[model samples]
Target: MIRFGQLVRVQDGGEYGYAVIGDNQGDYFTENFGAKPAWSPTSKGTVLNPNEVHHRKTVVEDQTITLFIDGQQILSNTMDGLAKGIGAFGFFKDRGMGSVLVDNVKVTKITPERPVDPDNEGVVPVEIKSSDMTVRLDEAFPRVLDYTLTNGKKMQGQPTKIDTIKINNVDIVPEVSLEKVSENSIKYILKAINTENKINADLTILLEVKNNTLEFSVTEIKNNNTSQKTNEEIIRTLEIPNHSLVSVNSSETNANVYGAKISTDTTVNGDTLTEVTDTLRSFNSNYMYAVISNSKLSASMHSNSQYSSGGGANDFVRINPRVKEFESYNSVGLSSSPWIYHRDVMFNEQTLELPEAKVVITEDANDDGVVNWQDGAIAFRDIMYSPVGAESVKDLVAYRIAMNFGSHAQNPFLMTLDGIKKINLHTDTISFTKRLW
Candidate 1:
């Protein structure tokens, strides 16, 4: 069958039903073929009824395919072989003497279903209902936006000018200043003055909701700057609802960028923390660490080298999801090339977005199917040495052991030697018990 420039083949098998995109050899139809049947034919002889109208329709969105017969759903399957798309289509019997009756065949493009807003359960799409939403900014010049650093340091930034604050292209300011633009989207722009030289530049912040997750992005535009300085810093802060505060799971370091990148210090909930540090030479030699609990999640960034050059900008976007905590931060690096770093933090607890490169935490790192004293020793060895490596390795053997042993712990990297001894005895006990059994 072909529709709207896509091809699909349907084969009819007696008794078993009908199959789509399957081959009929010697003109004899069989149950087994290329593609499965959309709907198994239950007719008396597996033959089309001459008195009744048989209607078939197939809908293809991207690679997903769905088939319908006589207004009744038969089956939906995807096949790459039918990718040639809609073109010439017809029916014919090649082998045994047979005839296929012609009927009215029609093809049309399928209309896309409306997308649901994640934030607002049943609210209309933001782009379609523009007038219902409004965005506003303070009209006052030199507006002060305050922020607190991860290290308990207080800082302030001033917006020298308000470029525009828009919600769905609708100008909303002064009289109806909003605490938030909308549940699903928020966008604002302003010219802010950096604290260092008081230089002015536009700061743009865009918030979008996708896949039941909210993403926040910040960008610094220095196109109007005349300063000869090679590096500079610009900071902008916005207050979101306190209830939206969740765990801080990841932080991305833009090379040559340094200091606490995104911190939830200003929020009512104090547990979330994300930091990134970079200097002229090297940064983030030590991977990030997160302390998670039922109620809150706290994370801190550690760098083997000290921060200096005092430069670069940072942007942090938080979303949802967690997987393989040990393998989360395997990449530790320093690069000379200037790049804007962006890291996605997943918040949805139901989704375990596993990393491509992951280090498994069983004493069975070698996958021998058994845990023994030797495995314990290997874990210790990795704990003492393997925490450093390239950013792209994904799975760092050393960090896996350290995470299992809980070494170089919270705050000042405190080592817990007792964890190793406990694991050692536990492994020994297991091995001895297994031998006896």
Candidate 2:
């Protein structure tokens, strides 16, 4: 039997989080801010042996906690609204008539570094220009100061004034510098130092300017405090402010643009009236790509994929894209911003690199000489449904079949068959069976 816990804020009030592995079962439980105890359980009867000694590890980074046994991850939990305070560590055993021996105990603080001086100055504004677009970086922090198109239309206005990168709930105002890699590419280097903790963190943002597109990628994240053996959760935020609308296109049917609404009405004269209203609408979800656009210009941010050490693609590397309304005083009345947020655990020290998240910009995304949600849909299709092999199609079909027929009382197989039949009726030259074959 093994049990270990961290962030033990209060002992007397039962305000802490812990993990337990015993009796062939494992669980990660927590009681935050003296709330009722909650737990996330792993598969029962799959944990420990009766007469065996095994290694156990627990990692607590920000709001995420993970438990590993014998180098295999057992359980992970993300608890929001956690108690704010430095806490202790603990080990426990069930009250039984058995002897337990523990040895070779080790503990390490794996948090990232902090800013050197929160009020340090000497940040110089830098601008990189292409043939059609020019982007200006903030002089005081690591954010976009201005983004202007060739038609002299500013996309980002009223930019964020403070540092948006947060580590361990502390905002990191890193020392900012720029290195011009090429005529059309620049690298923004941000370095932070924590004197008390003796740790340092470096983040690199690579910006490449094409004809009409300005691509931004977070190429590297490095820190001196973590190792390959260490597992820590890293949360990052990407914000594009002052847009008319932000669209999250995860699927064909799950596309929505916040801050704008379309409504149609029929009048007494039998004429249809269409109205597009712009308001503040908040949205959050997983997405393939997120697009932020105004009347004149638009930009889409693609998903960044990261692979793990086990040679499997980690789908949870990017968690959610959130859209919220920002304060704006523009003439077009567009006041929203799209925020592409990421929350994932980094298990190594080798300058964690991420996939390039391409930001494609255009005045007419769909090439239809118009700018609207239809253009956003085109951007979505270009990212989510690009060419793939037959194996991907087979996998998708298998997944859909499983979802429709697995352990459910209502099976929709007949409905799916009917839909396929309808498709076959529409296409006369090529039948559905022939296509599948």
Per-model C-alpha lDDT, please?
Answer: 0.28, 0.48
Worst 10 residues of 1 by lDDT: 353-362
lDDT by residue (133-250, candidate 1, tens digit) is 2212222321212222223322211212232332212232322112235654555465444334434545454544332122334433333555423333211112111111112212
Candidate 2: residue pairs that collide: none
Count of steric clashes across candidates, in order: 16, 0
> Model 2, range 188-211, lDDT digits (tens) per residue?
787866544343667787877677
Kindly report the root-mean-square deviation of model 1 from the true structure over all alpha carbons: 24.1
Which candidate has the top score in TM-score?
2
* lDDT for 91 (candidate 2): 65
